[model samples]
Target chain A: MSTVSTSIAPAAAPARTSAPADNTSFSVDFSDIGRSFTAKPERGAARGSTVAPRPVLRDVSLTVQPGEVLAILGTSGCGKSTLLRIAGGLDEPSTGSIRIDGSPLNGIDARCAVGFQEPRLLPWRTIADNVALGLPRRIGRAEGKSRVAALLELVGLTSFADHRPRAVSGGMAQRASLARALARNPGVLLLDEPFGALDALTRLKMQDLLLDVHAAAPTTILLVTHDVDEALQLADRIILLGADDDADDMAGGRTGATIVQELVVPGGRPRDRGSAELAELRGRLLAGLGIDRHGQARGVAATHTIPHFPY
Target chain B: MTQTQIPKPGTAAAVRPARRPIRLTSRRGFVIFGGALLPLAILLVWQLSITLGVVSVSQLPSPAMVFLAAIDLYERGQLTLYVAISTQRVLIGFAIGASLGVAAGALVGLSRGANVLLSPTLGAIRAVPSLAWVPLLLLWLGFGEQSKITLVAIGAFFPVYTTVSLALRHVDQHLVEAGRAFGLGGIRLFTAVQLPAVIPSVISGLRLALAQAWLFLVAAELLGASMGLGFLLSESGGNGRIDRIILAIVLLAVIGKITDAVVGIFEKWANKKWA
Candidate 1:
């Protein structure tokens, strides 16, 4: 009963699959995304608690343009997620306003869909059903069924539609999760280390797939990652987090900490990892992290700079 | 504009549409249901032994005699009437028990207050077997159909209740979070997400309740019913008509098996439809 097909093959949805829309416009916007934690950075509670509150991000501000893939590069702790949460409208900014498409965001809900490191699929449903989970449940049965089938098509998973999530490989499962998030037809896609949990080969495939989908949909994406090459290869502009020479650093013995260094990728679309431009970007990034040519830090980046990551 | 369209994959080639319910319930299904040939061959051996006077005719009637009695009962519509009566009782008792049990189970499973308040009484009831309630039920309801229905209800109740509640308890938390993330709230969460999530458990409970009802109905009917299959079994035993007793036993086996098959198919259908 749905005769809503358009002349352009922009993809149909009273049929299947969901993704970003061009006419439904938005570019990422944020002003002040802060999260605070009161920690006693002491060995023991001294004299009934000499602990103080810390502002992870004092008043972070950022804005991204349409078609731009903004990569937020931060160490394990520099409030990247907090900034993303505010930008995505999933969490309220501590003190400033956030607007996407010139409209203010208020609360828990956001206009964007995010892919977490974990592909949190519903175990009870099949891969196809999981992808279609975001489709409206109250629609007519015929419309709903067709939409589900179509969503499966876009995700490159029409074959595994009947297979449960547990029955699939991790990469395949994440693909399904991406499809599920895309089903919301968001204007912006937030990816929080979506490839952080994948193997190298599969992660490359996913990155390529993401690039293809981005080309097709033109969604403004904000990718959060700890990998420098990943940021350099994929981002239109990268925001570095850690060192802040503008402030006093001797208090906690943090000499050269994570700092924001915006680097333009010089070209659009997914790039080859070892290009000369990438090498230049990597050198710039390593310089930002305060690591010497020998890969040793010139000084402690920060006390919080962990020696070795278990991953 | 340059573009490339990659076709997605699927399994559509060898898939054949099946006739919905007939495969499960046609006449051919009854012909060899549960290796009937082997059981029939055993009955033939029994008949041969009887003819050779291996055991007293008074102790056991030949299979042929049981078959003739079954035919007679069928002709008089007594078999039909009894099957209908038992089926009705089972259905009615199942309705009461499953609905109430599922409701109570869901409440107990989802709400801390309900679990804390109602667990003691439910645990006590579940601990006792349905047979133990026969005498008490007879004394309370006076050998009427209520006693039998109540017994069936008890048999059906505990299994469904336990399964549904346990199913609710074990639902994947991510799915629940997804439901919440979708902006589903209030009654919508329970109806759309929680209830559907717990369906496999409910179906398992329903199948269990069906099996229990068939097995328990006979014992429940022992409390002096006038015209149920259990009553007929009692009367046949009293008269020592071994053939009629054997026929009743065969009838119970067939009825229980048929009901169980129906419920199993239903559970499968439910999974496919809602899932």
Candidate 2:
């Protein structure tokens, strides 16, 4: 593993230092984005019975600058993935529009590439072939080949290029999926819990690898994750999404989740995991998600009682 | 020797039996021998029944008599011609039917509009019995190779179409979405994601269609043909040549199995590469 990282270090260096300063990354702007899904009718229910549409996200608006790593943190079913999907053009918002690099986003935008929570690699194709699938259609054969090789090298998957998705471990497959998303050299990278399915140790390593990739390519990244510490460690800014406090009392209780809090993480890339500032922010972010830092609500003093051992 | 000491050459430890590798060819030979046991026993019983006069030779000829019939036909050069014609018809009809099946299947599988427009009619057509079309085919194409080949083609079409379409419909939706997210659509999506995903099912469908081809082949030949195994069976039956009839039946069984085995090889290769 040390040898693998050493090999990747040099490849990432040249792209960062030697490439001309012409920025390839694009800013993403979301204006009043909202999405609603009609509740699926119950099985054997009366035909033509109308089910009310369930609001998932409403009035979400944010702008991510080019080269920024913005983490959208939320609880499950809070539409963080939905927001990322909207940014990548995988899903469209019903109420508002998105613009990438000042241009209105259309269906399946070519300027953005997505890495799903699952690796989502084509099982039949080799890792290299799967990455090559992300190459732009107009790319020349030679350029596409070299681009795929560079991406495999950057992700430390050079040796496993010919292996299929099922033949590799989950971490390796996710790396291949990341390489595939990078192969497009997109202006914006939308990662929806790309490391969520990995083991804890692998997830940490993948987070470092993602930072390395961002440094090398310098593209705007919108990451959706539930891990508060992950957001603290990776993002330059974090946005918390959830339903408002009085959402139930507003307009027949049909209110959807919206941006509740936004904070600019106070540190540079590769922030210390154990730093006091990040720990405080982690506590705050977790509290926003309805989890108490010490298993008790804020503004309450707790008395510690030691367990009496019979021995 | 001490526990840490390495074993020297010719010592008991050094000479201990190495793990034996399983010989694939020998295992395959065992399987083949095992499979042939029942047929050999049947052959033995058949010969014994003739010797014991348990059945009349006119009704059920002995194995030797069937062998003699084969030899008699071989000498006249008609046996080779019959086998060759039957095989040719099956191959041609299978190829045509399978090609049409894939084309129709892909259309129906990929496009919801196409599925809605074509599936009902095709399903109804598939429900018609294999022999039911014989009269209409005869009337349309006459008593020639065309009618026989058409009948066989019709027999081979339905399975391939059904399996291919169903397999395509259930292909991993996540993989399809990933392909779309990477800017693939239409023909590109089908080739890169959908086609390879369904290859195993398509090969299995082909195997079924090949078997169906042979079935329709005999039907076509039995109804009307001058130079095939089915024709030989009918001709022999008309002349009360029980030996020739048994010969034709054996030939048909062997050839059908051979064709199926050929397709089985393809299925194995496809599964390894795609599945």
Candidate 3:
């Protein structure tokens, strides 16, 4: 446990009670990240299919700056989740590099937190107990309980704090999960479609909650999603993923295949949600995603870079 | 939908009442009470049927007849002596068997390399039932208390091993990865995450192993030894004292019930506290 504390002790900025650092920049450089393995998979002596495990991710490289949310937009089966895992140190790439805050990330660290699309709260724990799980041991039981109370309150789940995960609604479970991720006071958050499991209204509410958390901590966040409108609404920049051998170019290291271009916007925060810039950007991303006016997939598609211009 | 409030929204009173009588509808209490009633109901019916002469006197004795024999044995001090002998054998055997089984289960579960090495050997050992071990135990340890305990240990070993191994194989990959990511590996990972997660399954296995221990308890006693419940049953059977035999069988049932209840309690406590 102390080793974990040491591993996450970033020299650039200490973890803070409220304000971490006045610094406004953070960045990650993932270079040539890839992985492969081999296994029999079956456990029979008589007959078993043996095959060389293939690569789940290739030399995927990207850079994410601090206080900026990079929405990684990708289609299913294009290894978006795999890329996210590699970047978070949840997976070791077969060949490549990953640096967070200029320090190499070899394995999981306390400075980073990840939330999956599924609301993966521990079933046996109440919402508050789930939140307390990630808190540092120095807090002790009483303070840990209080910290859990505060996080649950922040997530608008004070009433459900004592409720087991099984008793809560899907939206409530996701909120509890978000609160758990927040408990570690992470600097870099990896959200894999954090609100994908929620209905539209709940998703919007979760989006607002996420934005507020970002405002409070001002942490560097890398959010992944397949939804183009979501990218337009939340990200400082959107990197579109395509299923091609040259997909590494859109990530800023290579240039061969890209459908939706990567473009950086100049916005700091609090961009107008209903402004024409956002709407126009949404339309372009929607087109890139091949979604039409009826909120359905479009027949026509185009590859134009996503820019972070604020109006 | 305003649905959250209509449910008589109370303070955390819903979960806090530590001494509150658990609702019968709640699964925990229901299982507890239902479990308690089964044997009592069986005894009541048996007592009633025997009193009514519904069964032949040779085949079925009234519950009272067994109770009277138990009192007679108690007065003679045979009950205490036999019960003590059986209890000691069970405890020692179960301890040895469970520890070995857990060690083997862990070895099998963690490494593919280890599984390939151990599976065929365990397969042959598991195929041989505890009853089949009686002759070997008598030959190995002599026809005394030692043989009896060895039989009980063999009975306990296989179930614990099989269940623990199966549960380990099906361990949640996500939790393992989470533990690894958190810098927990080698021993710490097993103690904190892997072990806790596998506990519910292990408890079930222990429960099964304990029942097997009881199953072999009689066989162990019957094979050798001059005391214990199983020996008492055989001794009574020799004299055609069916009432004493029935009493001993009833005693075995009672001990089995008690051990099961204890294991069940431990399982519930483990799941609630750690799981």
Best by TM-score: 2
Please, what are the lDDT tens digits per residue for candidate 1 over residues B43-101? 88898889999987788888878889988988998888887888878887887888888
Rank candidates by lDDT, best first: 2, 3, 1
All candidates: DockQ? 0.13, 0.62, 0.25
lDDT for each residue of candidate 2 in A1-311, tens digit (9 for 90 to 100): 00111111222223333334323677788999998776884634433358766788999988877667889999999999988888877777879999987889999998899999999998889999999999988899998999899999999999999998999999999999999999888888999999988877788899999999988777778999988878878888899999998877856766889999999887567888768676667777878998766734342212212224441
Candidate with top lDDT is: 2
Supply fnat for every model shown: 0.17, 0.70, 0.30
Give the per-residue lDDT of model 3 (tens digit) for B130-160.
Answer: 6788888888988877788778888888889
Clashing residue pairs for model 2? none
lDDT of 1 at B161: 88
On DockQ, the stronger of 2 and 3 is: 2
| CAPRI grade of model 3 | acceptable
Ranking by DockQ, best first? Answer: 2, 3, 1
Regions more than 4 Å wrong, model 1: A1-68, A72-107, A116-132, A135-176, A196-202, A215-220, A225-228, A237-267, A280-311, B1-34, B41-45, B48-55, B72-77, B139-143, B186-193, B271-275
Cα error, candidate 3, residue A122 (Å): 2.3
Clashing pairs counted in every model: 14, 0, 8
Which ten residues in a row are the worst by lDDT in model 2 chain A?
A1-10
The iRMS of the candidates, in order, is 3.7, 0.8, 2.8
Report the C-alpha lDDT of model 1 over A148-264, residue by residue, as the tens digit: 677677667899999988889998899988887776666667888888888776777788888777766666688988877777767778888774766655477332323368766
DockQ of 3: 0.25
Top model by DockQ, which number? 2
